[model samples]
Target: MGEALRTIAFKVKTASCGGTQCVNSFGDEQLAVDMLANNLLFEALKHSHFCKYACSEEIPELQDMGGP
Candidate 1:
Protein backbone atom coordinates (compact mmCIF):
# COMPACT_ATOMS: atom_id res chain seq x y z
CA MET A 1 0.00 0.00 0.00
CA GLY A 2 2.80 2.37 0.89
CA GLU A 3 4.66 1.62 -2.28
CA ALA A 4 1.52 2.12 -4.34
CA LEU A 5 0.87 5.45 -2.64
CA ARG A 6 4.46 6.44 -3.23
CA THR A 7 4.02 5.70 -6.90
CA ILE A 8 0.90 7.87 -6.96
CA ALA A 9 2.80 10.65 -5.24
CA PHE A 10 5.48 10.47 -7.88
CA LYS A 11 2.87 10.59 -10.59
CA VAL A 12 1.26 13.61 -8.99
CA LYS A 13 4.59 15.39 -8.77
CA THR A 14 5.25 14.57 -12.40
CA ALA A 15 1.87 15.96 -13.51
CA SER A 16 1.08 12.56 -14.92
CA CYS A 17 -2.10 12.25 -12.94
CA GLY A 18 -4.33 13.71 -15.57
CA GLY A 19 -7.78 15.20 -15.40
CA THR A 20 -11.06 13.49 -14.54
CA GLN A 21 -11.78 10.23 -16.26
CA CYS A 22 -15.39 9.72 -15.24
CA VAL A 23 -17.89 10.05 -12.48
CA ASN A 24 -17.72 7.48 -9.70
CA SER A 25 -20.54 5.61 -8.04
CA PHE A 26 -20.94 8.53 -5.69
CA GLY A 27 -21.32 10.92 -8.62
CA ASP A 28 -17.93 12.44 -7.86
CA GLU A 29 -15.49 13.18 -10.63
CA GLN A 30 -12.95 10.36 -10.77
CA LEU A 31 -9.51 11.53 -11.71
CA ALA A 32 -6.94 9.57 -13.64
CA VAL A 33 -4.85 9.34 -10.49
CA ASP A 34 -7.76 7.74 -8.67
CA MET A 35 -8.05 5.10 -11.35
CA LEU A 36 -4.33 4.53 -11.30
CA ALA A 37 -4.21 4.08 -7.57
CA ASN A 38 -7.23 1.79 -7.59
CA ASN A 39 -5.75 -0.36 -10.33
CA LEU A 40 -2.37 -0.46 -8.63
CA LEU A 41 -3.83 -1.65 -5.34
CA PHE A 42 -6.11 -4.13 -7.05
CA GLU A 43 -3.26 -5.63 -9.01
CA ALA A 44 -1.15 -5.90 -5.90
CA LEU A 45 -3.93 -7.68 -4.05
CA LYS A 46 -4.62 -9.94 -6.99
CA HIS A 47 -1.00 -11.10 -7.14
CA SER A 48 -0.82 -11.68 -3.41
CA HIS A 49 -2.91 -14.89 -3.76
CA PHE A 50 -4.60 -14.20 -0.44
CA CYS A 51 -7.06 -11.44 -1.22
CA LYS A 52 -10.29 -13.15 -2.17
CA TYR A 53 -12.44 -10.11 -2.68
CA ALA A 54 -12.24 -6.35 -3.01
CA CYS A 55 -14.42 -3.27 -3.35
CA SER A 56 -13.74 0.41 -3.59
CA GLU A 57 -15.31 3.78 -4.15
CA GLU A 58 -14.30 3.63 -7.79
CA ILE A 59 -15.63 0.10 -8.28
CA PRO A 60 -18.26 -0.58 -5.72
CA GLU A 61 -18.99 -4.06 -6.97
CA LEU A 62 -17.34 -6.87 -5.03
CA GLN A 63 -14.66 -8.43 -7.18
CA ASP A 64 -13.59 -12.07 -6.98
CA MET A 65 -9.83 -12.15 -7.14
CA GLY A 66 -9.57 -15.97 -7.55
CA GLY A 67 -7.69 -16.22 -4.30
CA PRO A 68 -7.81 -19.09 -1.85
Candidate 2:
Protein backbone atom coordinates (compact mmCIF):
# COMPACT_ATOMS: atom_id res chain seq x y z
CA MET A 1 0.00 0.00 0.00
CA GLY A 2 2.80 2.38 0.81
CA GLU A 3 4.53 1.59 -2.46
CA ALA A 4 1.32 2.11 -4.41
CA LEU A 5 0.75 5.47 -2.75
CA ARG A 6 4.33 6.48 -3.43
CA THR A 7 3.97 5.52 -7.09
CA ILE A 8 0.84 7.61 -7.41
CA ALA A 9 2.54 10.58 -5.78
CA PHE A 10 5.51 10.26 -8.11
CA LYS A 11 3.26 10.17 -11.19
CA VAL A 12 1.34 13.24 -10.07
CA LYS A 13 4.59 15.08 -9.42
CA THR A 14 5.94 14.20 -12.88
CA ALA A 15 2.83 14.61 -15.01
CA SER A 16 3.37 16.50 -18.28
CA CYS A 17 1.52 19.54 -19.55
CA GLY A 18 0.92 21.48 -22.81
CA GLY A 19 -1.78 19.19 -24.16
CA THR A 20 -5.07 20.48 -25.35
CA GLN A 21 -7.77 20.42 -22.70
CA CYS A 22 -9.79 17.23 -22.87
CA VAL A 23 -13.03 16.25 -21.21
CA ASN A 24 -13.35 12.97 -19.38
CA SER A 25 -16.32 10.64 -19.24
CA PHE A 26 -17.62 12.86 -16.46
CA GLY A 27 -17.69 15.76 -18.93
CA ASP A 28 -15.09 17.64 -16.96
CA GLU A 29 -11.76 19.02 -18.05
CA GLN A 30 -9.21 16.28 -17.62
CA LEU A 31 -5.97 17.19 -15.91
CA ALA A 32 -2.70 15.35 -16.46
CA VAL A 33 -2.16 14.70 -12.80
CA ASP A 34 -5.64 13.31 -12.40
CA MET A 35 -5.20 10.89 -15.25
CA LEU A 36 -1.75 9.89 -14.02
CA ALA A 37 -3.03 9.22 -10.53
CA ASN A 38 -5.89 7.14 -11.86
CA ASN A 39 -3.61 5.07 -14.05
CA LEU A 40 -1.10 4.58 -11.23
CA LEU A 41 -3.78 3.37 -8.86
CA PHE A 42 -5.24 1.00 -11.43
CA GLU A 43 -1.88 -0.49 -12.19
CA ALA A 44 -1.01 -0.85 -8.53
CA LEU A 45 -4.26 -2.60 -7.74
CA LYS A 46 -4.03 -4.84 -10.76
CA HIS A 47 -0.58 -5.98 -9.75
CA SER A 48 -1.35 -6.49 -6.09
CA HIS A 49 -2.05 -10.19 -5.64
CA PHE A 50 -3.53 -9.60 -2.22
CA CYS A 51 -6.09 -7.11 -3.44
CA LYS A 52 -9.51 -8.66 -4.06
CA TYR A 53 -11.17 -5.56 -5.39
CA ALA A 54 -10.86 -1.83 -5.87
CA CYS A 55 -13.15 1.11 -6.39
CA SER A 56 -12.45 4.74 -7.13
CA GLU A 57 -14.48 7.90 -7.31
CA GLU A 58 -13.18 8.51 -10.83
CA ILE A 59 -14.51 5.16 -12.01
CA PRO A 60 -18.11 4.09 -11.97
CA GLU A 61 -17.66 0.37 -11.30
CA LEU A 62 -15.67 -1.94 -9.07
CA GLN A 63 -12.50 -3.69 -10.27
CA ASP A 64 -11.90 -7.34 -9.45
CA MET A 65 -8.31 -8.21 -8.65
CA GLY A 66 -8.77 -12.03 -9.01
CA GLY A 67 -7.45 -12.72 -5.57
CA PRO A 68 -8.47 -15.70 -3.46
Candidate 3:
Protein backbone atom coordinates (compact mmCIF):
# COMPACT_ATOMS: atom_id res chain seq x y z
CA MET A 1 0.00 0.00 0.00
CA GLY A 2 2.77 2.41 0.84
CA GLU A 3 4.54 1.63 -2.39
CA ALA A 4 1.37 2.07 -4.37
CA LEU A 5 0.63 5.40 -2.75
CA ARG A 6 4.18 6.56 -3.32
CA THR A 7 4.09 5.52 -6.95
CA ILE A 8 0.87 7.43 -7.54
CA ALA A 9 2.16 10.48 -5.73
CA PHE A 10 5.24 10.49 -7.85
CA LYS A 11 3.22 10.10 -11.00
CA VAL A 12 0.97 12.96 -10.03
CA LYS A 13 3.95 15.20 -9.50
CA THR A 14 5.56 14.26 -12.78
CA ALA A 15 2.72 13.36 -15.16
CA SER A 16 1.43 15.97 -17.58
CA CYS A 17 -2.07 14.59 -17.68
CA GLY A 18 -5.18 15.93 -15.92
CA GLY A 19 -6.70 19.42 -15.93
CA THR A 20 -9.12 21.74 -14.21
CA GLN A 21 -11.36 22.14 -17.27
CA CYS A 22 -13.51 19.24 -16.16
CA VAL A 23 -16.02 19.34 -13.29
CA ASN A 24 -16.12 16.98 -10.32
CA SER A 25 -18.90 15.63 -8.16
CA PHE A 26 -18.99 18.86 -6.19
CA GLY A 27 -19.44 20.85 -9.38
CA ASP A 28 -16.01 22.36 -8.85
CA GLU A 29 -13.23 22.40 -11.39
CA GLN A 30 -11.33 19.13 -11.12
CA LEU A 31 -7.71 19.49 -10.35
CA ALA A 32 -5.09 17.27 -11.96
CA VAL A 33 -3.73 16.14 -8.63
CA ASP A 34 -7.15 15.11 -7.38
CA MET A 35 -7.96 13.06 -10.46
CA LEU A 36 -4.58 11.41 -10.56
CA ALA A 37 -4.61 10.60 -6.89
CA ASN A 38 -8.07 9.06 -7.02
CA ASN A 39 -7.33 6.95 -10.09
CA LEU A 40 -4.01 5.72 -8.78
CA LEU A 41 -5.38 4.89 -5.37
CA PHE A 42 -8.35 3.06 -6.84
CA GLU A 43 -6.15 0.93 -9.06
CA ALA A 44 -3.80 0.17 -6.23
CA LEU A 45 -6.56 -0.83 -3.86
CA LYS A 46 -8.34 -2.91 -6.44
CA HIS A 47 -5.26 -5.02 -6.97
CA SER A 48 -3.81 -5.02 -3.48
CA HIS A 49 -5.97 -7.89 -2.20
CA PHE A 50 -5.40 -6.56 1.27
CA CYS A 51 -8.90 -5.41 1.87
CA LYS A 52 -12.35 -6.59 0.89
CA TYR A 53 -13.58 -3.06 0.43
CA ALA A 54 -12.03 0.30 -0.24
CA CYS A 55 -13.53 3.73 0.14
CA SER A 56 -12.36 7.23 -0.62
CA GLU A 57 -13.60 10.79 -0.47
CA GLU A 58 -13.33 11.02 -4.25
CA ILE A 59 -15.54 7.99 -4.81
CA PRO A 60 -19.28 8.01 -4.13
CA GLU A 61 -19.37 4.49 -2.59
CA LEU A 62 -17.34 1.56 -1.42
CA GLN A 63 -15.35 -0.51 -3.92
CA ASP A 64 -15.42 -4.28 -3.60
CA MET A 65 -12.05 -5.89 -4.06
CA GLY A 66 -12.83 -9.32 -5.35
CA GLY A 67 -10.88 -12.47 -4.50
CA PRO A 68 -7.41 -12.75 -5.82
Best by lDDT: 1
Candidate 1 residue spans exceeding 4 A from truth:
1-3, 16-18
- Residues 1-68 of candidate 2 have per-residue lDDT tens digits of 57878977777677675563567667777776776677677777678777787776566488886665
- Which ten residues in a row are the worst by lDDT in model 1? 11-20
What TM-score quantifies how close candidate 2 is to the native fold? 0.59
Candidate 1 lDDT over 2-48, as tens digits, reads: 68778877876776545789999899998888888889889878878
* lDDT score for residue 48 of model 2: 70
- Please list the residue runs of candidate 3 whose C-alpha ends up more than 4 Å from where it truly belongs after superposition: 15-18
The models' CA-based lDDT, in order, is 0.85, 0.71, 0.72
Task: State the RMSD for candidate 1.
Answer: 2.1
Of the pair 1 and 2, which is ahead by TM-score? 1
TM-score of each: 0.80, 0.59, 0.61
Please report how far candidate 2 places residue 58 from its true position, in Å: 1.2
Ranking by TM-score: 1, 3, 2
Instruction: Give me the overall lDDT of model 2.
Output: 0.71
